[model samples]
Every structure is written in C-alpha cells, then in structure tokens.
Target chain A: MTWIMAALLVVVVFAGIGITKWMNSTATENANENWRDIAQAEIANSMVMLEEPDLSEPQADYYEGRIAIAEHRLANDIPSFEYASMQQQVIDTHMMMSLVTLLAVIMAGGIVASEFSQGTIKMLLTRPVKRWKILTSKYITVLLFAVVLTVILLISTALAGLLFFGISDGTLLVWNGSEVSETSFWLEALKLAALKFSSVWMISTFAFMLSTVFRSSSLAIGLSIFLMFTGIQAVFLLQNYEIVKYYLFTHTDLTQFFTGNFMISDITIQMSIVVLAVYFLVFMAISYWTFGRRDITA
Target chain B: MAEQAIVQIKNLSKTIGKKKIIKNLSLDLHKGEITGFLGPNGAGKTTTIRMMVGLMRPTEGEVWIDGQSVQADFEGSIQKVGVIVENPEMYKYMSGYKNLLHFSRMHKGISKERIDEVVKQVGMQNRINEKVASYSLGMRQRLGLAQALLHDPKFLILDEPTNGLDPAGIREFRIYLQKIAKENGVAIFVSSHLLSEIELLCDRIAIIQNGELIDIKNVNDLQKSRYYIQAEPLELAGEVLTGIGFPAVLHDKGYLIDSGAEHIPGAINLLVGAGVRIFAVQPYRETLESQFLEMTGGGEIAQTHTK
Candidate 1:
C-alpha cells in the first residue's frame, strides 16, 4: 500500500511539473514578440544615452562600451532567453526536490517515533507479534511515505517545468554559470530523489534507534532532526576528525551522488551504500535489543 | 482430567541496578485455575508477571510456558500467553473491534468468529464498535482483556486487572475472569494489590514483598486457618476469652481468635459461666488482605522492587 502511494505521488508530481512547464511555455510564446520588441527599444535607448554622456574621456569610453554590451545582449534571439528560463526552471526543480526530501525525512521520523513517544508502541508490541516484526512494519510504512512524498515533489516540479518551458528533445541550457545537461538534468533529478529517499531513510533509522532507546517519540524526532541538519557541520568542525565522515548523518545527503560530486576523496556509491547499510543494521539491532529487553510494566 | 502446568517459574531472580526486584521466586500456574499474584505497591508483583509473559527476562531464573522456556523461545511462549501489563494500552484512534482485529491478525490461525466470541465474553459486545478513545477506563480495561483473549490463549496474565475499577466493575471483572478460567480451562495468573478481589476470585495466591516470595497458598486453605471470633461487649471479651483458656484479641466489636469451631462451644460455655453474654458467636473467614499483610510483614517493605 505504501509503495503504491509513493508511485501515485510520483506520477502526480511529474504531471504537476509537466503542466506548470507547459503553462509557462505557452505564456512565454504569447509574449515572445513583445518581449523582443521591448529589448530592442531598450538597446536603442541605451545607444542614445551613450551619445549624450557628459564627456570625461574615460567616462565616455565606459558609456560607449556599456551601449555595445546592451546591443549584443539584445541581439540574442528569444529562443536563447527561453532557454535561460528553462535552465532556471531546472535549478528551481532541484531546490524543490531538496525541500521535498527534507519533508519526507520529517514525516518518516514522526511515524514510529511519535507512536513510541505517545506510549502507543506498547499497544503494538504487546500484541503477540515479535518486536522485530513491529519495527519492520513501522520501517516499511515510513519508507512508503518517504517514497511517495519524494515522487510527488519530483513529478510536480517536472510538470511545472514542462508547463512553463515547452517539452523539447534538446540539450539542457545552463545559465547562472552552472554546468548542467538536459539528459543529466532529469536523470540527476531522479537520482537526487533517490538520494533524498536514502537520506530520509537514514534519518528515520536514527529516529527509530532513538525511539527504541528513549521510548519517547518527541525526543527521538527532535534529536534526530537536530542531528540531521547540524551533525554534519559539527563533524566538519572537529579538528583531526578521521572517522567522523563515516558517521551515517555525514553521508545522509545523496546530492553529491546525483551531482557527480564528492565531498571526501574516497567516497563512492558503493561506499555510501555500505555505510548506509551498516548504519541501518546497527540502528535496527539496537532498537531490537532495547525493545526486546525492556520491562513493559508501564 | 490431565493435570497440566501451563506456566512454571523456577528460582527466578531479577535485579535492576543494585535493587533486587524478584528474589528466588518460583511458582507454578496450573491449567484451569485462577492464581492471584498479591503484593502491596512496588512488591515485585508487576515484575514477576512481566517476566512470566516474556516482557522482561529474569536475571537468574527460567520461565517456561507450555513446556517452552520464555528466554529460549519468547515468541513461542508469548503466542500461548495472553497478557495485560498494568494499564493495557490500545490504539485510541481505532475502534475496540479494530483493536481486537489488529491483535488477532498477529497470531496465526485465529478466526474472526473467535474474536467476536471473546469480545462478547468480556461483556463489551455492544460497545465493541465504539472508538477506544471514547471508552471509559473500565471499558478500556474490558477491551484490553478482549484483545488479550482474541487468540484464545491457553494462559492469561493480567497485571492489576482491577486497578481503577469501581466496586461494580471490579465485581463484574472477577465474575468474568472466573467464568473464563472455569469454562475455557485457561490458566490465569493475575497480579493486583487488591486482596479482597483476589480472595473472591483466585483459587491460589502468591504473596510477594520487597522482591521476595513471602508465601504461596491455596485461598481456601488460608481462609480456613485464620478466623475472627465475635462476642458481646468486645472490650471485656479479650480478658473473658483468656480466662476461658481461649486467647483472643479484641478487634472491631469482636475478638480475633486463632482457634476454630472445636474451641468455640467451650469458649461460649465459659463466657456464659462468667456472666458475660455471648451475643454473637461468628467464625470469620480470613480475608486475603490480612493474609497478604501477614505474609509480607504487615506491608512494611517498599513495593517498588521491580527488577
């Protein structure tokens, strides 16, 4: 059921992004000629202003150079402008994805941990089921919510991008001095979403471990979230920190993977996977041990 | 009838930090009997119950249910044991029936019909559809019991089952517990500080105090040995009875005597001879409260010794 919700949410997000991009593209097309004319008029006015400059020889030279720059900027066609807009949309999509990932982590962090804090975990645990099964069920539920939420954000951003910028099989245009490719843009977006999902899982795992340890949902949630944002920074500040990079929270952000970037020299996808797997197992083991041994007299 | 032991705790000892909660506690809960675990507050009653149900492991003992050790096979032992630890918590958002259904699904081979049967048995048939949040404390307790009984477990362990219950509710709970034990032949091990309820319900009782097993006795046998004798003019009755060679302590308009019916007639004759009216010659059955107090040294030990 959770997986299905995730899939549906992903579809909805993509459709939303597509629709938004489509709408923006249509609006751009409608105002294309007017925008071109406006640019031309502005360039002409700049040329006239340069001719009337109060002449200090260097100032006149600088004014003439500015007019030439304005003319060159205006000579670029509307297509280039539209392409720049598309590039901005991709960046905006990436930002939205990051926001969505954070939201997913928060949601997953609350699911099981909240139950523990509220003392509702007693209800689940006392029911003839093994403690591990209860934890697994909660873990699965959180994963489902995370996947669904991320997919929805991704799809929505994509739909919005498609609606504003017409869908065309062309190379992605990069503005703002950032190197990005269209093929890489969508693929990276998907990978970024996956990374966010993994990061959120890591956060949820931490929350689960804390939930089991403290048996308080709010405490686990608060601590996990605080660590999620600040833990990396704290680890970075530590002088001669050799093993801090291996900390699960340090590798929680999968953006580096999607962006083909590495914060540490030896980090790789396999390494990240191994690190995450270890953290995941350790958290589960601790949770199981604590829960299994707890005296449920309360 | 095959005499089967459903639960057996052997030399169980538990210590949390430096304080020992359960000390060399050994007990046997036989099939088709209601055994009460009696103690004052923090008397290790809850601790012993939790260990039996596999909620907490004993530090130096073994708990076996249906021939399987709880530590060795917790899942197997727990599957056969229905438990309500302290105030049993249920999902407040879910309906009473839904809670039962949720628990029922966890145990393999339990049918929906059995769930409905147990709900009705616990006398919550009409209110089973109501959300648990809306239920009163007593109602929630009934629902908790219903959920515990969903899989028709062979052994039932309830901690403070009558806690927070009114007089009427407590009476109702006792009756239902008796019925369940007798009708289903389910072995019941219930823990509570209320001795009166235990006296009325349990066939046997284990008294614990300060993490020590003070005594375990048949309720009937405990009642038989202890008696309260009533006579007219209770203030002078203690001296009068002592004069008649039957020592009695004046207590609440009566004299508590360790002696039984064999000495009652002789004492009555002697009282009449001394010009004292034998207004009432009543034999008092031992209340569980008195027995518990006697076993635990008048409840002096702290009840918080749960390891």
Candidate 2:
C-alpha cells in the first residue's frame, strides 16, 4: 500500500508539472518575442544615423519611456516565468513530505498502540520475553517501516520530476540560494529526501513514544499531527520573545540547508544532528521509563 | 495436602483510591493442591489474586511464589507462576496456536512439543488454527489457561476461570484443573464465587470477604461441622431432644436433631416409643452453600449460582 500510494503521488506531481510547464511556455514565449521586436526597431533606428530623430518633446519622451519599459520587461520576464514552475515544485515537495510523514506516523503508532487498544498487550506482556525486549522489537519495526516509506517517496518524486521536465544540464536552482549541478541534482535530492525522512522518523518516534505511553493509537496519531502543524509555531512564539531556540521543534525545518537560511548564527549540520539526537533520546527515555513502571493490568 | 508450599502471601494489602480491596490477606497454596479462593463479588478475591501474580503490587506486605518474593524478584517469581487475571486479553487477530507460540518464545527452553502439549491439554488442539476473534468466550478462557501454562510453571493462578462457562464447560474445566494438579504437581490457586463449583473442584478452600481472609478450611473439615439430622418425630421428640441437652429444630415431616453419635440410638428409641411413626433417620452434611454463607458473614452471593 505504501509503495502504491507513493507511485500514485509521483504520477500526480508529474501531471501537475506538465500542465504548469505548458501554460508558462506559451505566455513566456509571446512576451519574449514582443520585447525582441521592440529591441530590433531601436537598433534599426540607431543604424540609420537619420537626422537625430527629433520630434515634439512629448513624443520623444513617450518613445524613451516605451524603450525603458520594454527593456525592464525583457530583463525580468524569464525568471518570473520560471518562478511559477518553481513555486509549484516547492508546494509539491511539501505535499509529498506531509504524506510520507503521515504514513510513518500511522505505521509506527499502529505497531504498538494497536496491541494495547485491542487488549492484546496482556498476552504479549505475559510471555517469557523481557518487557524491554518487546518494546525494542516494536521500535525497530517502526524504524524499518519509516525508512522504506521514505525511500519509496524519494524514488517516486525523482521519476515523476524527470518525466515532466525536459532534461536540461543546468544546475538545479533552489530558493535564491543553494545550487546543485545537473549531474549531482538527483543525488542531492536523494540526500535531502533522506534527511527529510529522518525528520519524519523523528516525528514517528515521538508518536510511537506517545502511543506507548497513552496506549491509544488514535490519540497518538492525533497528537502527532497536531504537533507537526503547531510545533514550529509554538517554538517561534517562544523564541521570538527572547527565549532560547534549544526547543527541538524550533530547529526541525531542514529547509534552512536547502534554502540558505539559518535560524541561528553558526548553525551547522552537526548542530541539527545533535539537537535531534537529544530530542529522540529524551522522548524514548520517558516512554521506556513510563512503560517499565506501568502496571499492565489495564 | 502435599507438604511443600508453592505460593504464599503474608500480610498482603492493596488499596485503590481510598478503598481497601485486599487487606492483610495471608494464604498458602501447597504443591499439587487445587485450592479454591472462594468469595462473593467485590470480596477482594481478584485483587488478592492479582497481587499474588505480580500484576498489581501490594500496597503493604509480601507475596512469595516458589520461595521468591514477587516484588523483589518479580520476573523470576512470575516465571514460575502462571496467571489468568479476570478476562485474559489475547491477540484476537492471531491464531490460537500462534498466540501460544508467541508467548512460548518469551520463556527460554520452551519447545514446539511443549506448545503442542499445552494446546492439547486445553482440548484446543483441533481448533487451535482458528483466530481468537472466532473463539467463544469459553475457548478464549481455555486459551488463556494454555498460555498461562506454557512455561510449565509450578504454580497456576486463575481468577474466575469458569466465570462465563456453561455447565458442561465448567465441568470439563474442573476436571482439567484436577488432572493438571494431580498429574503435573502444579499448585492451582483459583478464585471463584461459585461455592458449589469450588466444593466440587478444590481440595482445600479459602474464604475472603472485604479484603480479609475469613477462613481457610479443608472441604471435609467444613463439611463435618454441621449436619441435617432427619428422623421420625416423637410426640415429645422436639422437647425430649432439647431436654436431653441437644437442640433440635422441628421440620414439617420430622425433627432435625443435633445429637452426638452415641446419643442417636437413645433419641431413636425414645421417638419410637412416643407413638410417632419412626421410619427413617438420615444425617446430612453441611452443604457448601451454607458453609460459604457462614464463612463470609451472610453476604449476598451473586444470582448466577442458579444458572
């Protein structure tokens, strides 16, 4: 099911890119041709060396304003056209991330929480296996699922993106900032996708911990989604008021690496790794401690 | 009545939210003994059993299984104690056999043969392939017992093992418990409010009420304490029995005389001479129902006893 959904998402994204490209090609080509015609007329008049084309002052001024306007349009038109396609790609990327994150959360939440919700934890807990081992097994299963799901999403996005846009050897342009060569674009995207996957995994782990603690799959899923949407906002509200940015969610957006934006000075990839590792450990620690001490009679 | 104690609780107490559910409860279950933990509803029977199985820790005191404290060495103690507290929750999506297999993996050294043995022991060998969702409540209970017995634990703690069983199911379960205790030497500590069922199944009985141990007695000992003596009525049999220093209650057909064996003949002779038809003399041992009522201070037994 996960692989199938990922394939479908790729198809939809490629279809969207195809339509955007077609629409912008026509608009941009017409605008470019119109400006080129004006530039040709100005060059022709300059070559003639005709008696300095004197005219009534207002008429001369009008032609000068027209030339300035056309030059400005010629300079900025192509980028504006490209920006339309880029914006759509950004939206698609975010949408894919959201879908992948949702799937990861559900998979992780279901692995353990389903047992508790269905009252099967009693039988499982009573077995000869140590309680810690049982929890560890479930955690590993969720992590594996997250990895597989992320890989599928990344592969699908690349396949769809290539099919929609004609192959060009130009560097992949990201928001006004970071650049990647055509040869490295796919690989870089894979790396970014994997990092994005880790972010999803982080969320899934948080949900898994909540699932273990609350023993309700629905509650865990709901809380996870709510946190995903509101977490950054809450962190920003706190950080904006002179609070430290040490909160885990405050640094969750990995776009800073792709967009050349940084929330703090001297922010490095290693710092992000450290912050996430600490967050993951703290979440897991609380979950294990609570589960170890809980009475399973419930 | 074997000598070795398999499970023992001393001064155990458990309170939940201001209500004392099990209070200073002490009891010993011997090896190879099918001891019935008999009590009425809300009598703290399940609470005491839960504490014994380490499902719930006692707020005060100790529980020892196989000579180890349940609190200090919970995993070790639990390894030797098999428990089915109330309704045993099982993975409904998994096959009954798979459930057993899953639980079997938890205890080291459990073989495939042992899993099969327990499945057969519970009489679920034929239907073990079916998912637990398709199992009847009786089957689920049997499966629960099978899982509990998976590791071949020395002590078995079952709370209301036959709570929702039909008559035949209950009978079959009782026989199974007896066979396990006698054949395997497993100490069976079972709790139920069914006095008649306990009377039939358990060798020894413990009565608990409102978190307190009211009495622990051998079935035979309790049976001997009271008897219904029915005999032909003498014209003055009621007065004559009382005058002879034995109290007698008058029934519709005859007098229920409470007299020693030695005095029976005298009462019989006197009743015959009083011109009353002297047809029969029968001694009735105390029924478990009356014994339960007496032990638990006349609390209301649940109505399911009739069903």
Candidate 3:
C-alpha cells in the first residue's frame, strides 16, 4: 500500500512537470512576440481580482507576490525565462505538497486506527508497555515518514531539473520590493522544502490525533484530509466574526505567518506558534486519555 | 492477606451504556494450577478477562495481580500476566516471528533465545518464519500462545483459547497448558464454553452465567457418586431399591440409583433376596458435560465466546 502511494506520487510529480513543459513549449511559440509578457500581465491582473471580500493576509501576500513577479519579469530581468530553471523547478515540485500531506494523513491515521479496525489493538494494548509509549512510537514513525517524503520530493525534482536543463550557473533570487536577496541554490531549496513540510506536518499531526481517538481508519483519514483542504477556507469565510482568529483550523496553516502575510494582522508568527502548540498538546492529551480509558471489546 | 493468590479479582463490575455487563465478580488464581472458567454465551467471560488485562476498564471494583491493581497501575500489574483474549489477533502482513519480535520489544529481557524457546514450546517452530496471512487458524492460535508465554508471566489468561484447533491440537494444547502450570508454576485461567475440554484440562472449574459467577469447584467433585445397575427382573429390582428409600430411575440398560459404593452391595443383596437376579453393577462416573447440563438446567452446551 505504501509503495503504491509512493509510485503514484512520483508519477504525478513527473507527469505534472511534463504537461507544464509541453504547455510552455506550445504557448511560447507561434504566438505574438510578447505573448509571454501578456501572460504575466494576465496573472498579475488575476491576483488583483482575488483581493475582494477582505483578502486573508496570506492570500494578500500570495496575490501581491504574483504581481511583484510579473512586474519584475516585465522589467530589467533577462529576456528569456524557462520554468525548468533550478529554483523554479524546485518551487513547482514543492507546490505539490498537498499530495504528500494526503499520504501522511493516511500513514499517520492508519498506524493506530488500523489496529482497532483489524482487532489487533488488543495484542498491542495488553503488552507490558504503557499505552502512551505505543502512541508516541506511531507518532514518531509518522514524522520520520514525513521526512522521507520531503527528501523523496526534493531528489525527484532535482533530478528532473537536471534532466531538462543541465547544470545551469544561475543566481537564486527573491524579490522584496526594491531589495533582492541572493543565496545558495541548495540552501534556498532546503528552506522552501522546510516551509512545505511545515504545512504537511500540521495536517499529519491532526490526522494522527484523530487516529488515536477513532477506531475506524477511514473516519480519521477522511476527516483529516477534508479539514486540511477546506479548514483554512472555512476559517477564511468565518473571518468576518471576531472569534474566527481563535479557531485552531485558522492557525493550522502556520506557513502563512512566515512565507506570506498573516490573515489576521494581530496573528504574528509567535502567536501562531503558541496557538499551534496549544492545539498539539490538547490533541495529544485527548489521545492518551481516551486510549487509556477505552475498552477494547472489539 | 490475599492468601498467596497471584490473581485477585475483587468485586469487578462493568456497565456499558444502560446495560450492566459484568456484575460484581471476584476470583482468585494461584500458581501451579489451571482453573477453567466455564460460562454460557454472553456470560461476561470475555468482558471479565478484558478487565483483568486492562483492555477494558471496570465501572466499579478492581482486579489485582501480584498486589498491583490493574486499574491503577496497569503496566506494573499487567507485567506479571499474559493474556489471549477471545481470538488471538495478529498482524497478518508480517511473519509470525516478526510478530513475536515486535511484542518482545514491548517487554524487558525477552531475548531471541526466549523467543525460540516459546516457539518450540507451542510447537510452531517449523512455520515461525512464514507470514501470518498463510497460517491456518490452529497455527495462529499456537502463535498467539507462543507470544503470550514469551514473557514468562506468572499468570496466563486464555479466553476460548482453543477456538480453531482440531481435536488433536486441542488435546496437545491442554497438555502444554498443564505442563506450563505445573513446571513453570504459571497460573492459567482458561475461559471456555467447551465443557468436555474443560473437564479434561482444568484442575478446578469456575462456572458463570448471565454476568454472574455461578459456582467454582474441583473437577473431581463436580458431581456426586451414582451407580448403574443391570439386573434380571429390572422393574422389580428398581421397585425394591425405591422401597428401601433409594430413588431409582429405570434407565435403558437397567436402573440408575443414587448410592455410594458401600451401599451397592447391600442394594444388590436386597435385590437378589427379592428374587431378582443381579447381572452387573458399576460405579457411574458423571461426565462434566452432564453435570454442567444439569447445573445450567439443560442450558445450551455450544456456547459461543465472541468478543
């Protein structure tokens, strides 16, 4: 089962890359001389249109960041740009982290809930070891799986980039208004990888907590994934209410605080971390408490 | 103060929703003995065993193992025990040996040598390396027993431990359980609805019914002494025996008279004196099945222990 998920992820990643490369080839040719330029303008205009109904701070950063990219590409940058460039390739691969998060939810949820579903939890719980240790081992295993997935994602993208555009001595650049920062390509890639994994871990841990409390693996996996993809949007819709900021789902996407703008102005990175920490502890406490008290009659 | 008993269950009760599943039940299990826990279907045997192993919490009261309360100190108490509740469930994706190894990691001082020893003890050595998915139900039961004995726990609780075994396998399991109890001084608590199996296996038997402990007695003392008689003029012989204040029922062969060995000769002499030619008289040993049937008031013997 795990291998199947891995193979599917690999195929999805490379297939997505192939489709994008083909589209770029077709769009870049046989059009007006400034067709690429026109596309950038359209992307910027779409970002501007997303600002209605009080844009989330993270959405604002994302929309405004696209505008920045279009402005820069239209200005003094190089004339020819390819998506296969190392940094762009890395970003494109990392952007598919929702796939990683989905698998992580299954892995984390299956670890404990499978025992219950299959009636094997009696053997697990009756051992001399404490219940907490069992749950902790599964949680750590999920974290390790997250690390493995991140590494696999990075390696696959690097290999793809090397295959498409061999060995380029290009600068890793980030645009912040008039100021631009340059860093080692690998270092920048690692930072982006960490940022992507942060969001994955958040979803995985939520799934792990649900697994502990639930006997049905499908329930845990389904609910966690459902919330992961829609939880932020739900909170965004509710953001008009003052209490929405206190919602854990809103804080679950802590990447907003660091990689972009905070949806709520007062929700700094520190506040987000504290909120996440509280949720983590509460989820863990519920897991241990329920596990200890649960009757394994099944 | 607990009489040297390794397992001391005190007033254990469990209630799920509005139904009181296990009433206040108490039991004592000692080392070097195999006690049969006999009960009909839904008699709370599995529920009691689950609470004993801390797989389920009691609504009230406690189960103590070697002076440690299962409710209060589950690890410390459960460390002294091994259990196979209802059916032994394993990860079918892994080999039997891997399952044992995984369980061994949960305990201290369970070595590869110990694993091999248990594998050999349960006679599963030949197929230990095979994936559990390929195992027959009997083989899985053996693996389950092997894993339970790996820790050398003082008390072993097996709920319907012989679910899938053939008759030969069951007989062998009974012998192994007895050997473990006598040689290793492990107290074995076997809960099964199999009366015949319990008759052959247990030293003492505890009976339960409808969420209550009914009775506990030695296998030897399960039924009172009775005699079977085959005689010419059987009706006359039965009438004479009944007239002499012995209640005699006419059986297929002759008559069934409730009398001890000493009175058998006297009854025979009376029958002969009454012109009844006595042919055969033998002491009838009551099977545990008949006793159980009589006790449960003709209750169903095929009790299913489902968890």
Q: After best superposition, candidate 1 residue A36: deviation in angstroms?
A: 18
Shift of residue B177 alpha carbon in model 3, Å: 1.3
TM of chain B vs. native, candidate 1: 0.81
Winning model by TM-score? 3
Deviation of model 1 at B92, angstroms = 1.3
User: Residue B182 lDDT in model 1?
Assistant: 94
The CA lDDT at B226 in model 2 is 27
Descending-lDDT candidate ranking: 3, 2, 1
Which is the winner by TM-score between candidate 1 and candidate 3?
3
Off by over 4 Å in 2: A1-95, A158-190, A235-239, A258-266, B225-227, B230-280, B303-307
* Model 1 per-residue lDDT tens digits across residues B40-119: 77778877877786667688999999999888887787888888887877888889998888878888988988988888
Interface RMSD of 1: 2.2
Please give, for residues A143-246, the per-residue lDDT of candidate 1 as tens digits. Answer: 67666676566555555555556453333322222222223556645655666567677877777678767766667768877887787676566524778668
Q: Against the hidden reference, what TM-scores do the models get?
A: 0.74, 0.76, 0.84
**TM-score of chain A, predicted model 3, versus the true chain A, to 2 decimals:** 0.79
Task: Order candidates by TM-score, high to low.
Answer: 3, 2, 1
* Docking quality band of candidate 1, CAPRI definitions: acceptable
The lDDT values for all models are 0.70, 0.71, 0.80
C-alpha-based local distance difference test score of model 1: 0.70
